[model samples]
Target: MEQPVHHFSELFEQLGLASDAEAIEAFIQRHAPLPESVALHEASFWSPSQAELLRNALEDDADWAEVVDHLDASLRKP
Candidate 1:
């Protein structure tokens, strides 16, 4: 079985964000509970490049998609 190469820290790095565990957790906490009406890529907090990366990852189902989905879930209401 193949292990996924993408992870939350790496995703943050790709987004040009702080990639440490504490930073990631804080970021998630800060922006969490995102409304069901919003798509992850459409979130206003991201920069243009970050949004584009997220959009492409999901739209193309790129290698980053799995972790991207994880992040999206983390930010939204359970």
Candidate 2:
């Protein structure tokens, strides 16, 4: 089964915010830099190592908006 989709609000909450899209965006950008070499649609490219690195970064930094915008754009890419 596929993982359920979450609204930006939910993501914000998960990231420890009360409720704020802008804030969530800020948090993600500060912490999660999109992997430059990974193809967004390549499922296999999102390996465990990549995930761990993302997780580690998120754990450390929690403030940045560009990351959220990048993620949104990447997801919309064809």
Model 1 regions more than 4 Å off: 1-4
Each model's C-alpha lDDT? Answer: 0.92, 0.48
Worst 10-residue lDDT window for candidate 1 reads 1-10
Residue 13's lDDT within candidate 2 is 50
Give the top-scoring candidate (TM-score). 1
lDDT (10s digit) by residue, model 2, range 1-78: 643554657544544454576775564455444455654323343456544443554455444233544454644444
User: Per-prediction TM-score, please?
Assistant: 0.91, 0.31
- Prediction 2 TM-score vs. true: 0.31
How many backbone clashes can be found in candidate 2? Answer: 7
Q: Model 2 — which ten-residue stretch has the worst lDDT?
A: 38-47
Q: Which lDDT value does model 2 have at 21?
A: 67
Global Cα lDDT for candidate 1: 0.92
For lDDT, the strongest prediction is: 1
